[model samples]
Target: MSMEHHPHDVFFRSFFSHPDTMQALLQLLRYKQMVWQKDDGPLTPILPILFYHGPDGRISERFSQLFHPETPEHLRPQQVEFQAILYNLSSVHKDRLTAEKNLEFQAALLSLKYARDNMDLMIDELYRLARTGGTVFLSSKRFALVKLYLLHASSLTYDEIEQKIHTRITDPVIREDIMPSTAQMLKQEGRQEGRQEGRLETVHETVVRMLAEDIALDVIARVTGMTIEQIEAIRQQNDQTDQNQS
Candidate 1:
């Protein structure tokens, strides 16, 4: 599948979709544009931040570094000069992420850093967060997003994931809220194993669930083993169903 359709791409894009993640860039451009258009007030300075979480380290921080290396030093001063605050999750220590006071932010960074290669560590941090952060962590929307990320990003089976969640979170209500039903898991496994036929309805339901979660079409296609065309059709049908019911 294309990188654009990849599960990790979807997961990260969804995880970072919150405004706070891109607030700096938004504010910077908005204020700068306002200052230019209105010419009534000084431009508010804003820091630019780039959050990166790839297997390799970031190559450069300064915008000017992207220029040709042979560019003369004398002319360098004319080039745009600015450094973004880089939060390279790959380089950040797990301890530092765990130390983050904001439980939601900590979970996001940890998931980004370790979800692929370090599932054990990721689960451990999540367990820790759930245990320590208590009702607040369990109730937040981030918890659901994190759970969804793990479902797609990790190689662990659905039962294994549920077991881990069960082991970590002792509250029955929270566990019930977090875990998918056995029927759902079986349907997911059958879909993954390419069992169609009578399962079309099941598959459509799964697609609808993922779509409701704001998962990308390509990502849903990958997960459900459906074509983008099919998923789009289901989405349209779903929209019509909602419209007619309303």
Candidate 2:
């Protein structure tokens, strides 16, 4: 696909293009390098951090724990005994995550924690956070990025996402700022392709395109004026065609 049509490429380009974002990223890299330097010079004090948000709990904390069970106990002292500070979002309470002082961090953590299982609740929590003084730390652009992240990570349709944002977030300025991103998302979903063709796209073609974009079946049915069963039939046919081609 073209770079212009790729959602990830577009998001990264727009995100990193900002001077503040670029500088913050560079500073983070510099700090990491400084803390974990492995040059000929004396070693820097290293404090590793593992930010984990998977469904499973963390299995190990120290490097030594990875050693073979058959290894001699006497050799234990010779092994590197490195330990990392683990920030396991899966194990953290929602209230604790919400209480985080950094607005960006709180939003990010909540998003990661719930993106797989409960994206709707995550959106509601984000809206609540914004309502309660979180907007001070988030620019419209940053909040838009957060919304884009939701779109990327969640299974919700674009219309559903728009509805959630519209219903939950009442700030007119913030809503206005997010309009451009909404357009970008629509373009990424191939919404503009139909317009550019100078003719209305057929139901079959529209369904195929929406399926490729991973839009929810109900949403596609609503847009295309078809039932969920009809959409599912199209999806199955498309899948069968792909298998035969392969």
| Every candidate's CA RMSD | 10.5, 15.2
In the range 134-161, model 2's lDDT, one tens digit per residue, is 4464454445445545665567776777
lDDT of 1: 0.60
Give the top-scoring candidate (TM-score): 1
Q: How many clashes does the backbone of model 2 have?
A: 0
Deviation (Å) of 229 in candidate 1: 18
Best by lDDT: 1
Cα-based lDDT at residue 186, candidate 1 = 50
Relative to the true structure, how large is the alpha-carbon lDDT of every model?
0.60, 0.55
lDDT of 1 at 66: 61
Q: In angstroms, give how far residue 188 of model 2 lies from its true place.
A: 8.3
RMSD of 1: 10.5
User: What C-alpha lDDT, on a 0 to 100 scale, does residue 40 get in candidate 1?
Assistant: 44
The list of candidate 2 runs beyond 4 A from truth reads 1-41, 65-80, 133-142, 167-246
Give candidate 1's error at residue 23 in angstroms. 16
Give one digit per residue, the lDDT tens place, for model 1 in 121-237: 777777678778877886776565556556666677767777777776666765675565433555553545658688777677777876665454544665667897887688668
